[model samples]
Target: MVPFSLTAAHGSIHASTKQVGCQPLASKGLNHTEQQAGEFRSSRRLVLLLGIASASSLQRPASATPYKEAENIQYGLSNGNIRPCPGGYNPNCVSTASLNDLYSPVWRSSLTSIATSAQVLDSAVMQSSDKAQIVIKRSMPNAEYLEYEVPGLFGRDFMEFLIKADKGAGGAGEENSEGAIVLYRSIAGNVKYLYPFQTAISDFGAQRKRLEAIRQTLGWRKLGCDLKECFE
Candidate 1:
């Protein structure tokens, strides 16, 4: 028979092995809890930060409202748009029918449709083969001009942004501000111009000066007419 002391020692060794195994399992459980807590705290902090950011944004001041464009005239070509008349007209009513009819050829050649409210005129026929300079004069007094060209965008219409500024001499004094409008045009076969809503002659003059400054800074050739009469 085995000695009594030897049996007791064997039991002790078995108990010690079991204790060692259980100690690691308990330590693993503790580590898992700590990891989960850290993740939960991080998520909570993220949610709190997002909520604070949203609240701050809501407290900011609102932007100024934009100016509204004029309504379309009742009579003209294809949708009551102002086109060059068959014959020129009296200087008093330069925007009227007779004057538009006179410039019909130019209007017919370049303009496809004119959006009065948007202050944009789209070129109907694509004149890609020949390089041509397009000129547009509208009856709308406050109508301004911007030109851009893009292919297959805006339903294949040449992109044009209508911009306006005061045509008065006062615009010459202050040319840098948010009130200044910008027009963009691409070199593709698209031809478009932007006209801002009812602006004074002074505003257009100031906008023109700012554009000239940008052109000078970028080393680009000056484009388009800066006639005070046009802006007025």
Candidate 2:
């Protein structure tokens, strides 16, 4: 028979091993719970991030209207004699006058004289004599509107000039005073994809320079001039 002490020691060793194995299983269960908690935290963080993005999008302001849609719409002329182009953008047009500044009143002259001078200036600077044509001339009690067409490679560019007498500053009332407000817009022709480049090449600096030369020729002082690019 085996010794009693030896048998009892063997039993104790077996029990200790069983307890050690059972401890591992308990640890595995705790680890599984921790992994589940970690997954839950990640999911919650994702939800928060999505919620923030949605809120930010909702809080953003609406975009401004496009120029084409708003170009025909006119605004009341202010003392500055300039107004923002509808929608604040025009891809086909550029101007050397701004709506931001109060332009100095210039001495008023006859519309016929101004138009003649403009035509002469345009003919002198244009690439071809036949390319420029005066299309419209209208006169109001206070303002004169003149539009010119310049043929381009793809289409015809249009220029509109507005010359208005300052309030009570010209004509019979103020014969000696010759100050007037002048505004002009050079619009590109209707050729898709090439309109911007055409406008830039045909107008931009070239048109502005011609206008300045005309202003100097007419003995008008520069008030405030600006160049605005068309929004693509």
Quote the lDDT for 31 in model 2: 78
lDDT of each: 0.31, 0.48
Which candidate's lDDT is highest? 2
Off by over 4 Å in 2: 1-89, 96-129, 168-176, 191-206, 216-219, 224-232
Candidate 1 per-residue C-alpha lDDT over 1-232 given as tens digits, one digit per residue, 9 for 90 to 100: 2344444545655565455445754665657666567556655655565565556546456543222111121222333233321111111112212333211111110111123322323222123313223343343334444333223221222222333332331444432232323232221121122345322122222222322333333322212334442232
Q: Which residue ranges in model 1 land beyond 4 Å of their true spot?
A: 1-132, 139-141, 146-161, 166-179, 190-214, 217-232
Residue 117 shift from truth in candidate 2, angstroms? 7.2
To one decimal, what is the Cα RMSD in angstroms of model 2 from the true structure? 17.7
RMSDs, each prediction? 22.1, 17.7
Provide the TM-score for each candidate, comma-separated: 0.17, 0.41
Per-residue error at 116 for model 2, in Å?
8.2
10 residues in a row with least lDDT, candidate 2 = 223-232
